[model samples]
Target: MNRSERRACRRLRVAGAGVAALLALSACSSSDSDSSAQLDSPASASAPDKLSGITVFAAASLKETFTTLGEQFEKEHPDTKVTFSFGGSDALAASITGGAPADVFASASPKTMKVVTDGGAAYGAPATFARNELEIATLPDNPDKIASLKDLTKSDLKVVLCDRAAPCGSATEKALDTARLKLTPASYEEDAKTALTKVVLKEADAAVVYKTDVKAAGDKVEGVDFPESAVAISGYPIALLKKSQNTVAAEAFIALVQSPAGQKILSRAGFLKP
Candidate 1:
């Protein structure tokens, strides 16, 4: 080959090699840029893995429904655990105000919930999630033939009612007042479950308690709905405690209780919608 032709071919080959090197360098630079960008991006960050435990102080009437919801919350958040303290709403409120460590408070009545709010123990305004009506819970087959509220007033019939301080008792009182009838219970129980237990254990012929408790008793007790119950429905309220250490988890639980899924569970447990 002639010198000029050979020189031109060598130059062309050199130029081709340089172009290949530049392309390779560009690709490497682009890849490095992408890696850096991803590292700096918030969207590429991993989710938090911290464990969260929440303590909930709920009313006796909410035991079944809240327990079901707590189980679901734990299942949805594998890193979370829910602990419950269930009892009379007024008592629970007193505990919270007395410096009990709790993340949430679910009360059976607005009056009890107000105890916490008025004490400034709540993080925010409480939300009413459910309502409960009064019912007469009697032994299986209702041997006492307790078909109405007045049946409880009949002499010689052993009847039990919640304490006036309790939400269930307060509701029962309102119901009796609505019917223009007065009742003298054999005893005043501390909570609805305790009141209902009187009939379940056959300790008393009948007990005025929340319908939810009666339903929860299954075949253990028969529920008698009175027309007066409409006027005595108790509103259930829930709120995050001001002293909550795990606010995130507590808020999530509150959201669950107010969600459609949670409402369905409460409804299935015989609780009314707020």
Candidate 2:
């Protein structure tokens, strides 16, 4: 073959080899791109579901109000199921300290909340959400003619008071002390709600409880306002627990309680906003 032809033949061969290599590289790249795309695509999106279940420990005085609030909250957040245990603030605090599986706690007094905070059992700062003032709860008919705080100290009134250990009881003590009166109650209840219950069931002629509690009791009891009650308002504080298994749910619940809707609900239930 001629030299030029030989040179041309070599060039053609080199160009043909280059085209084959390029084709092979393009095929490998296509395969890799397909594999990468598959890896990059998201698996699936999950629909938000209700938190399995959350346990809330709240003060006894919050029974009706919190129960109603819980029902409303559940309706608003279908993904969350709220359960509650309502008792004296001291008892609830003790339960939390005893390692009870509570996701949230609503206390009737800062003193009870202090117990939780001091023990390092709370997850965050407790927020005061509501205020409650003391009131004289009497039988539906007010048969005793009890008119004011001074009436409570009458030798024949037959009154029931919460134990001083309870928030309501302590607040009652403070109010009475502020008014310079000493009362000899027929019985000292373990909690305010219990004292009110005593009056409702005709076990006592009168009792001291939160204004909200009397309202919650409806016509079953008659509420008598005393000027001294203004001095012993109880602030309600709520907090999430540090060891809550449902931290996210607990936080969501707390947020709801602090929201305008929550406040409205509480207000409708006779709770004074903080």
Candidate 3:
């Protein structure tokens, strides 16, 4: 089997006792047949993680890096299953406020996290785990010769930007304002990924998206760095929800995100330390 499948089978094996605990807490785990395959092994035989399943709601910009971190966390805590829900930070915050069941919420910006914290959906002080900034994502060849913030304002260039409600969009606006340049894009998307996708798909000539999104796109597009982006750096904050079913597991997941290993994964994905 491949690595991920082996890890999954290992998780199932390690989840012998966890299956019993999970059933007692909530009926949201593996099937009976899977659980029947293994009886409780001695704790000394193989020490498994205390947590069984951890669901996290994270910002869209965190998808690639968080997935890597989540898998690493599950490896460390073999009994735990980490599931993620990634979207615009604002949308995820709205869902949390609307009572969607989630253990952790990792927002792209502190302002979005405040939405849940203000509504009493979060339990403790949120930690700023990482930072990100905007960049110009253009076609592979960048035929238009787009270089800086001002280059986007060229009348012929078709540009896409994230909606102002999202962190990336707000950051883009700040950078534009910092450079004293005004831009009107062809369209406004919901998140940085969507904005970057427009450029990747050739639907738009360029887009203002997170540096991470541009990096995640790999050779699908090219990233253009500009000085004004420094004016709008966004802080990523993570917190445990107040209504979590397994507080211990949720807290442990948050701790891993702030750990050195997690930081390394994020840094490799073009994220900056908070």
Candidate 4:
């Protein structure tokens, strides 16, 4: 099915599922089974009663889906509130390690999560939650007649890329290297959203960004599939921070994201199964 069809079908299914067990899902790198099968309720079986709140630091690519997850989390645990800080996963990891007030960390790449895991900022080994791949996002129409990774090398094409420092940028580099192609970008964006925004805003002709970002952008952008994307897939990982004040609520939130409900929501957003 296409995007609209999938979204419509999900709405009908959610309408019937009720509010107490709200969540979403998407694709990624986990070897674990869908956790939602056993933890479908608003609160996990081990969740505490009347918890105050939980704060999550996640990748910018996860903003849309995680927002949905946050809302569903609040509904499931009415006593709890979910607040999020979304940006480049690497930056978010930096903030977490710098003593940012956050309960959980969800990163777009394992390399960024390593910044925390290596620093012993995380409570334990982070679990691979999902995976994402890069796609060429361009203006709604094929104005540039852009086709493959090689097409991006056109000197006349104004290409935007995520900075090599970010996960999306790193993935873009991998894809480019796989194709044995390199083209200078007009500008290097700080994050995937900004890179995509350039295409939507008509400031750039094309951008290499996360597939999920293009999916979230909807009609604002058009996505081009290329073979090299499979070679540079990004893995998403999530874990509780050592400074967590409410581990019960925090754990419940991560559990919900890893649950089937979370997976379905994420799948709708174009994220790959773990």
Give each model a TM-score.
Answer: 0.81, 0.80, 0.81, 0.81
Residue runs of model 4 more than 4 Å from their true location after superposition: 1-51
Global local distance difference test of model 3: 0.88
- Greater TM-score among 3 and 4 belongs to 4
Give candidate 1 regions above 4 Å deviation. 1-51
List the RMSD of every prediction in angstroms: 12.7, 10.9, 17.2, 22.3
lDDT by residue (tens digit), candidate 1, 32-131 = 9998886554333222245368899999988888899999999999888999999998899999999999989999999999999999888668999999
lDDT of 1 at 237: 92
lDDT of 2 at 256: 80
Task: Show the colliding residue pairs in model 1.
Answer: none
Global lDDT for candidate 4? 0.88
119-167: candidate 2 lDDT, tens digit per residue: 9888668999899889999999798888999988888778999899899
At residue 177, what lDDT does model 1 achieve?
Answer: 91
The model with the greater TM-score, 1 or 3, is 1
Candidate 3 backbone collisions, by pair: none
TM-score of 4: 0.81
Residue-level lDDT of model 3, residues 1-274, one tens digit each, is: 8999999998888798788887766654455544654322222222225447878999999999989988888888777889999999999999999999888999999999999999989876899999998889999978899999999999999999999999898888889889999999999999999999898889999999999999999999999999999889999999988657666677788898899988988899999989
Clashes of 2: 2
lDDT measured at residue 53 in model 2 versus the true structure, 0 to 100: 66
What is the clash count for each candidate, in the order shown? 0, 2, 0, 23
Residue 232 of model 3: what lDDT? Answer: 95
Task: Assess each prediction's global lDDT (C-alpha) against the native.
Answer: 0.89, 0.86, 0.88, 0.88
